[model samples]
Target: MEALLSQFSFLSSQALQDKNFDPTKIDDLMKFFELEAYNSWAAMETDLKKDVDEAEYTMKEAEDHLESVMDSAMDEFRRFEEELDRTLKDELDGLEQVANNAKKMGSSMENAATIATKKYMEAALVSATTTMKSAWKGLNFNSKKIHPS
Candidate 1:
């Protein structure tokens, strides 16, 4: 029994020394995601403001160019419509980029979790094996003394 206790203490201390659990990686990942999200949101907001400003400028130019001429007004209107279409396309592309970045972040987090779980399982298995080995040795010693052959 004393041998078993000493063996268990030694093995447990060794397992502690070889621990693989690291929490800093998780904190770093979260910080990265937070910064990425803020940057994306800021870019989208800037693009939206610029697009609105451009549309307003075009409208002002259209008003100044018109002088009771229907054909000229129609041409300016067409130009404004094309500019609006381009702005919408730009916004859509930005949204798509943001979605892709979010997906990448999620996958990175999942991979981190998987790695941590694997490390934990490996440590548990090592401890279990060590305990079994110690118990088997103790049992064998006692059995030999009892048999004396």
Candidate 2:
């Protein structure tokens, strides 16, 4: 986060430098004009007032320009944030679909296992019944043959 702030600061400084307006040089140039030592003090005062007004206007223009650039940067950042949010939401939705599908497959497998167990139990019961019936018939036939006197 600190790195991001430092980058922003550097960008802002570079933008200001690109304007090419040095306040120290402007002050020095104004001092060279020497309006303070003019013969007519009132005219000098008016000239000074005009210079101050011009400086104020220049400062305001610079501030407005910087504000515009900052606004554009913020708009770009907001767009990136919105896109990131959309991507994350889409990925989360896909993951949820996968999880639901896995759960459905598990349920199907459990139902198949239950059905197989029921079928096996029914087949075992039928086999046991047939074996018992066959044994009883054999015993009765043996007794009849022995008593035929």
TM-score of each model, in listed order: 0.43, 0.53
**What is the C-alpha lDDT profile of model 2 across 1-149, one tens digit per residue?**
35445655665576588786455654544454444435357787899999999999999999999999999999999999999999999999999999999999999999999999999999999999999998888776545455456
**Every candidate's CA RMSD:** 55.9, 22.4
Instruction: Determine the backbone clash count of candidate 2.
Output: 0
Model 1 misplacement above 4 A? 1-68, 138-149
Residue 45, model 1: Cα distance from true site in angstroms: 70
Worst 10 residues of 1 by lDDT: 21-30
Q: What lDDT does model 1 reach?
A: 0.79
Q: Write the per-residue lDDT of candidate 1 for residues 1-149, one digit (tens) a residue.
A: 35445654655566567677354544555576577678889999999999999999998888766644677878899999999999999999999999999999999999999999999999999999999999988776445455457
